[model samples]
Target chain A: MNAVKKIVKAREFTSFLFLAGLFLVVGIINPAFLSVDNISACFNSSMVYTLIAVGMAFAIFIGEIDVSVGSTMGLSAAVAGTMIQNGSNWFLAFAVGILIGVVVGLVNGWGVAVMKIPSLIFTLGTNGILRGMMYLQVGVEQVNSLPKEFKDMSSKTLVGRFTVYYCCAVLLTIGIHFLLTRTKRGRYFIAVGDNAGGAELVGIPATRTKVTAYLICGVLSAAAGIIFASRIGIVTSLSGNGYEMKAVAACVLGGISLSGGVGSVIGAGIGAVIMASISYLLVFMEAPSNYDNAITGVILITIVVVDALMQHRAAVNNRHARLAARTSAVPGGKEGLEQ
Target chain B: MSDKTPKLGGQNGLRRLWNGPNFRWNLFLLLLITVECVVFGATNSKFLSLTRIFASANGDLTFWYVSIFVTFVMITGGIDIQSCSIVGLTSIIIGVAWQDFGMNIWAAAALAVAVSVACGALSGFFVAYCGVQAMVVTLGGSFLYSGLGLLVSGLSSTEAYKGISGFPDSFKALTKTKIFDLIPLQMIIFLVLLLAAYLLLHRSKYGRKVFLVGVNPSAAEYSGVNSRWITMSTYILSGLAAGITGVVMTSQLGTAKSDLGGNFTMTIITACVLGGTLSTGGKGSAIGTALAAISITLLRFGMPLCFGINKQYLDIPIGVLLVVVVVGRAIVSNPTVIAWVGKLRGKGKEAKAGA
Candidate 1:
């Protein structure tokens, strides 16, 4: 019973369990899918998704969203891809890409925190502007022929098929996750997201915290763009289109709340692997790629409904326990329960 | 029944207009439209011609149709991004029914509308009954419907990329027909739609209930209104609007595809916000949506024709305009900005006195 309680309380546990069960189920149907190389390949492909989901987790943790992450990723990829293709220094290309993302993030933060505009509409507008700029930048030609070293970096693994980029991204995400959950300043993200007014009353500088969250989200999304360019070896104007929804789905799967103040970047990373593996899984399942969006939609609805039902049942059980302990003269049970 | 109040005219009427709740936004929209018109006309003289303006305006019949219902959803404090998907779904359904199932065009249109309404009910159920977030559910719904649209296209044995063309000439004439060689039929259709939406949204008892539900659903429920039912009904209404838009777009394009009205989600939402429909809900008008749609349509046309902008890049100005307008509105409404204006005025007065 205590084990059940612990598992229930640990939100990320379900996500990890789901991830394992997913791989098991698919592996059962196709034994080849269980191979270490194939599975590790899934992790490698999930690097961009993991990055964006972690970034999105930061924004969602702070009780907001940035739909422009897709466009930010796209614009970054386009600009960086262009520079790299044109023989520009790799560092310069990455700097320009990240600079654009920072500018977009600051604008979004100003609109959302300082100017008091809704994050959805603000980021949506940025999405449009960035996508359009990407279109203008890459007219009639995709950016190709990135440097050999950068292109090879995605597959260059020291021990096993795990790419250095995915490893680094995972480690960075875990580090940030610890900082967010364990540090004093890190708690502000949750405090502000949980209740900005209450957080302000307690002197948390809710607006600054929210702004910082957006900045971090921006930086991470820009980093994902850099990784995407390196991994894909090319960038079309529409390279990252519709990726925002995938990231959002990953966050939800990872146990992050859309309404904010819950979940972890580690969970988002796991969820990203699950989400990014769907198209690859399709090959083994012999299903057409057209089912990709539908499958994602079904998974999203299923997990959310399951989560909601579990929460509801837990609430009901808690209420019954409290009532039973209070009204019924259960001395020890009542005393041992939380106040 | 108390009809004895004296009619106010001229200055009094102007005063009433100024004091009205949506007056500033409405006036701002009007001035902005006029300024856009003048600026575009200055850039290209051909843009100012009335016939050309009307011709360009008639092209956005689908947007005008979608915006009216978007206003309805926005007024209720929810958004219907899935309406764009519904347009695609409805268009594909009609095409498949007509071409593959050998159904009559009109009957196929009816079936498409019914299916769209069912889609709305599904999303509405989650939002109203399950207490899920409207945006997230609709976002999911959008994906589901668009995918379903593609699946249906696959079932039709038609390659999805080819789309379903060879629409009947009569159906094509439905959108192409002009009245008296001067006025297009779409203008009249739009005007009638505007009147119907205006009456339904502003001049009806249900409209009052909708507003109350948006403003405070709990209070409305206490007052005997079924808030969930009201909310669900608005989505059905919006779905019906999307169905109409699908038919119009199909006739206009003379084809139906899974990607119909691809950019309309943003376009219509921009129209609603630009025209004065509050995103937070409970404050929008069909008239405002219409005005905004017209302005946006003109901007879409003028940007390319007058300023030589590539069609692909038009989204930049549209996005920048949306952010600027919403942020500008926020600044205008902020108390600190108002106080600063007053302080600056006081400082100017003191400076004049010293001079």
Candidate 2:
């Protein structure tokens, strides 16, 4: 009974358990899987996913989803690559890339907030349009001539062990933590998600708050695109094709609900780690590489189920704990219970 | 009552246009086709040739046909992004069972449809019973089914990118063979499907129930309408349509790729919206959606052929068109414009009376 109680109380804790167990299994299958070099490689590749997931957290927190982030990322990279190829300085190129992201985010927010179009449809259209633009502008031609400094982003080792991108991930997590918990805008963002109408009643501008959330999401997504381009050392039209789904999956795994208003920065960061680790662990098991995508699908479904059950359990536990506290405090409460 | 009855007929015929179930928006479709013909002909004389038009129409018809079914799904306030993945899976299942395993083609097709319908029902169950939002459930579904499609393709001898070919001649005939030796068999199939959908969505009792359910499920429930069944059935119908379209597409292309129907979710949803189906639900038309699909299919093939522009840039025009139509609708609703137009007409009438 106590074991059952323990399991119900610790949801994310259980996810951590499952994630660790996966690594253990992989280590047993192939001892090389636990090697520092391979682990470092996983973190390096995952830095992009982590960046996008954190940005997506803000949008999901504000009761919206940006399916166009993947395309926005792709579009930004294309813009950056094209500008750089045209002899623009790297800084100016990066700025142009980030600007494209902001423009796409603003259009999305306008459609949703001002025009009152549903986010699902509006984002779907934008995703298609932006993706088409990326393909047209960049074609399938890979950009391979990036400056050495940019390419060094993923290659640099920090403290003689961890990759520079991993350090960036840590810094991003801390920054997001400060932005989400310590800031006034972050509180209003949460308030809007929790109940938009109630927040509006209390004088919060829900539309502007939602729009700002998307703007931050857009900027971060573009930054992730830049990192991905640097890591790969080339830009392809396919670069950001499936990434939006991956980022969303990571956020969901990290305890972010699609309905919004609930999640944590640290939890989402861990979620990114868990997902990136899954791919590495599977490869080590000598499992057919083809099964990796299927495994991702299965894991995503399982996580959502577990999250739902955990939410249900938490609700029940809080009710029970409140009842116990009330009974203990009230005079004759014990007598009433006995009767 | 008699006085009001006279007034009804005394009003201008144009006044009834807005109140009519099928209005000028429907008529606007014909104008677009005429404009397309004239523009394309002027730009490229070859565009008016029979073979070019037929080839383009044949290749694009299946997608538009399938999108017509999505119009129903959208009307019920549900989306089925998984339909794209389902199309791939169905085609592969048909290909493997019939071609590789040497099973009966009809039986394989039926099994494929069953698989698709079952997948749709699973999505519906999540939405109806578990209280999950339809968009999230379908988005997850798109990932799951697409992954499943790749796995199924891997099981077959055909490479994932190369796709499955060598389908039976009769199956190919489903898409390529002509009805009157002129119209492609697929277009005929599309027309028949459109007619069926038109009757199902407009003339049937259940159709009315679907609109009610979408408009207000709680109120519908109180009215003793089985909103759950209505919602679930739309998904099943959507699945069936996707499955059939998958079979037709595979036949038409002479191959089955896991990504064959990839990127269709956006196109179908766009077609639905371009037809003026409210994304929030309770307002849609099969006829309007079908016309929109036709327009889109023509635009995709016609623009590049006429202008000699890259096909990839076509998304710009389509996106701009969608925004324009939506914004135009909003502008039409402004009271100031309507009143100003009315005053101008009234002043003109007074001058005519003086004359």
Q: What's the TM for model 1? A: 0.92
- Candidate 1 achieves a global lDDT of 0.85
Tell me what TM-score chain A of model 1 achieves. 0.92
The lDDT values for all models are 0.85, 0.78
Measured by lDDT, the strongest candidate is 1
Q: Which stretches of candidate 2 lie over 4 Å from their true place?
A: A1-18, A28-31, A85-87, A274-278, A305-339, B1-18, B21-24, B330-355
What is the C-alpha lDDT profile of model 2 across A115-187, one tens digit per residue? 6666766777788788888878787576768777777767888855778877878788888777787998778
The residue-by-residue lDDT of candidate 2 on B34-61, one tens digit each, is 7888888888888887667778877665
- Taking all chains together, the TM-score of candidate 2 against the true structure is 0.88
- Which candidate number has the best TM-score? 1
lDDT of 2 at A198: 97
Residue B6 error, candidate 2, Å: 15
